[model samples]
Target: MSETTSFGDWLRPALPLLLLRLLIDEPGHGYGLVEKLRAAGISARGTTVYPHLSKLQDAGYITSHWQTPETGPA
Candidate 1:
């Protein structure tokens, strides 16, 4: 548990850099971003990841849009 806490402590300092890298290939939703972190060997859970997403959004390194379908019968 201590190791996990320590890693989380250390990793928060580099959040901006990692977030930049994650968005480099493509913009992603919050959950997709977490998977990208894992692919890079960073274990990012929702508690850790969402805050970083909030920070990155505040910093404007990326942007997000909700998907909409145009095939409605209306």
Candidate 2:
């Protein structure tokens, strides 16, 4: 649909900002971040999010590491 496409376009520029906010949020990670954006109606994918993440990292706004999810919460 054009609306979804346009909305996605409109949202594309904001991915980095949103991603930063999500990182400040609890339990943030690769798939969870994507899912949250999708849930918020962004139609986010790696092509979009990964670049912004890389940019944010390059700018020293965030970092990444391997998170091993536990079977249960601590």
Candidate 3:
């Protein structure tokens, strides 16, 4: 594969791990995860991050909810 494609190949697998690691710091909503990914230098878009979040929720690695009064970023 070309260099760019190879990089993307690696990134695809790493995204879930990235999301999990971010949540390890605390819990986050969809948008929060997107920002954390960006801030972590992961260049993730919502399209990618949200679906992963859903999968993570289904897999029991993470959870979610509406922004509550005491909810904070992860």
Q: Which candidate is the best by TM-score?
A: 3
Query: lDDT of each structure?
Result: 0.77, 0.80, 0.79
The backbone clash count of each candidate, in order, is 0, 0, 0
Error of 1 at 13 (Å): 1.2
- The superposed Cα distance between candidate 3 and the true structure at residue 60, in angstroms, equals 1.4
Root-mean-square deviation of Cα positions for candidate 3 versus the true structure, in angstroms: 4.1
Determine which window of 10 residues in candidate 1 has minimal summed lDDT: 1-10
Which of the two, 2 or 3, has more TM-score? 3
The estimated TM-scores of all candidates read 0.68, 0.71, 0.73
Q: Residue 9 in candidate 2 has what lDDT? A: 75
| The candidate that achieves the highest lDDT relative to the unseen native structure | 2
**Per-residue CA lDDT of candidate 3, range 1-74, in tens?**
65456656777789999888878878777788888778867777899888887898899977677654655652
Taking the tens digit of each residue's C-alpha lDDT, what string does model 2 give over 1-74?
35345666767787788998888867476677899988987788977788888889899999777656686542
lDDT score for candidate 2 against the true structure: 0.80
RMSD of each: 4.8, 4.8, 4.1
For 1-70, candidate 1 gives per-residue lDDT tens digits of: 3534677787888876887887888776777878888888888787877887777778886676767668
